[model samples]
Target: MKINRCIAPLMISVILSVAGCSSSSKEDQVMNANLGAQALYDKARESMANGNFAAAADSLSALDSRFPFGPLSHQVQLDLVYSYYKSGKIDQTLATIDRFIRLNPNHADVDYAFYMRGLTNMEADNNLFQELVGIDTTDRDPSKSKQAFDDFRRLIQQYPDSKYAADARQRMVFIKNRLASYEISIARFYMRREAFIAAANRGRYVLEYYPDSDQLQQALEIMVECYDQLELTELRDNAMKTLKLNFPDSQFIS
Candidate 1:
């Protein structure tokens, strides 16, 4: 009986040790979910190359979480941003870009983040339905356009020598034109409502801020009409002179 009791205890201890070892090994396997950082990055790259951006985003997100301190971490984050953008996940793209910019202010590719942010905001404001239906959006809210303009402006000012600077400058011009048109639309609305002072102020705002916009002539015309309505003869004459000076063939000139 003594011998059997001693043997039973020994067997139980051996079983517990084996079970403990097995559990430890499984935990290690779960902890090191990935084979290695390089292999996972390669997998993500392959997914991206296959045009499977959702899969690529998933893989890249996993790699980012698993190997945040790895040598390829920056590149991984950039790739993830691209994946999110290509996947049409604008919110995620913007959030990831903001996080990247905040975390890597001095990174060599930080300029890319700014460029992507501008592009994403521009995309967010693009109403495909309105475009297809031929609905004019100039009078609509321009909050996203304003944000995109700010992003591009910051990129151009802060990274003048960046490779994307030229493109940012071009986009800024387009945004300025759009914003000018928006102001003109509001001024016309005010004119229709008989708010001559408000309309003239909006026109002046366009001239002051968007000098090179394509809507310069329209702004001047609005100013002239509004000032005349308000009985401001001097301001009306000044707006007319400027309009004739700039646009010799303006309808308001004759």
Candidate 2:
């Protein structure tokens, strides 16, 4: 009723300042609501549900960083593995899976971890030609393929009753057959170069290591051709006879 002008202005300024601070605080909270591990984890799952794999991977990574030993640590890591795979982070997927398998060997979902590991390795990039025609894989690095094969084999042997066992067995067969075919490619390359001895050695490697593969028939033919080119009569005749015995209608027998 009798306020001085100076006092009234000062009071008004104070109220305005307080109101600004409250608004700013609420805004900050809203902006930072996703900083917590639980929030980030939920966001990651939601992103995954929507097929936003890249966002899911980022959120899962944030969750892992924020709560390394939190209640959801194991699940976060496991989810990160899947998110990384779906987002095409092949290296990250493989590394996360290996870490999971090593740290949680007896975990209930260890079989799934192995299966994912195999899938990551199997999906690793190969030579362009190999990716298309599936030849010359042996000429290139076969390390990942071999690793994937072993991973699948281990999963099948260790967890025969696992839900993933059937798929693992099928993948193992595919990898084994591909490996055998790779050997045949190598043998064929050596033959084209007229390196008969080298071709024969490759053929022998396939026959010895992949006896059950479909490429075994081609390996026998390679041995026969290479032995003949090298003028090894005894080896050539033996290979020819084996080829005839195994593939009675083999076109190369004559």
Kindly list the per-residue Cα lDDT of model 1 for residues 1-254, writing each as its tens digit: 35587689899999999999889757644544655888777877887999988777877887888889889999999999999999999999998999999999999999999999999999888899999999999998889999999999999899999999999999989989999999999999998899999999999999999999999999999999988888999999999999999999998887
lDDT winner: 1
What TM-scores do the predictions have? 0.84, 0.81
Best by TM-score: 1
Tens-digit lDDT track for model 2 on 15-87?
9999998887576445435578777788789889999887788777777776888999899889999999988
C-alpha local distance difference test of each model: 0.90, 0.85
Every model: Cα RMSD to truth: 13.9, 13.5
| Error of model 1, residue 137, in angstroms | 1.2
Per-residue lDDT, model 2, residue 117, is 90
**What RMSD value applies to candidate 2?**
13.5
Q: After superposition, how far is residue 146 of candidate 1 from its true place, in Å?
A: 1.6
